[model samples]
Target: MWSLFALLLGLVVGSFLNVVIHRIPRKESIAFPPSRCPHCGHPLGPLDLVPVLSYLLLKGRCRYCARPISPRYPLVEALTGGLFLLASRFYPPGVEAFLVFAFLAFLVALSFLDLDTFELPD
Candidate 1:
């Protein structure tokens, strides 16, 4: 069940990554104003907020307004999931795993933001 645990961990991290992605651009506090749709400002229900499956089920559109969702959601979730698998295989639990996980997360976020905004902030 380690894989399942890893997947669950990845999902939680993916949720935080979504917050980071949304806030980093807007210069807002990630902790403030719980997750909401930018287009309609509706707080996401739990079902509407599942990491990758929700996006797929909704066909990548906000349920409240039907606005097209960005592909970044699944991409980040998949990316983190893959990294978790690879990390578990390559490194036992220790500092290396933590470092690698952190690096992988930062890289994913940086690459995605650069691709979307075409500018580097950090």
Candidate 2:
């Protein structure tokens, strides 16, 4: 059950990480504009934003404009979920696990940023 909880939390965090990856490089505020379809600029609603599930349900296309969505979104969510599950299994319940999670989050963020900008931010 704890592993499942961690996986869910990872998925949610991965969703936020997508926002961070897209907005941070562009100097945009992550909190102001909600997640939207990049190709169409459509403001995504709840159903359109459910991590990996939404991508699958929409057939990897935007609900509003039928634009092909990037597969990276679901890939990041799955990767984060798997990492969280792995961390839960390896680290005992304490500060160690928390530190592992924090490290993983930074690595993931840096990875996406690299993919976006072709360079890591200094």
Q: Which candidate is the best by lDDT?
A: 2
Pairs in clash, predicted candidate 1: none
lDDT of 2 by residue, 24-74 (tens): 999999998888789888899999999899999999999999989999989
Candidate lDDT (C-alpha), each: 0.81, 0.87
The segments of candidate 1 whose C-alpha lies over 4 angstroms from its true place after superposition are none
Write one digit per residue (lDDT tens) for candidate 1, span 53-113. Answer: 9999999999999999888888788778777777777777678877877887888778877
User: Estimated TM-score per prediction?
Assistant: 0.85, 0.92
Write down the lDDT that model 1 would get.
Answer: 0.81
Pick out the ten consecutive residues of candidate 2 with the lowest summed lDDT: 113-122
- For each of the candidates, give the backbone clash count: 0, 0
Question: Total backbone clashes of model 1?
Answer: 0
Top-TM-score structure, candidate number = 2
Off by over 4 Å in 2: none
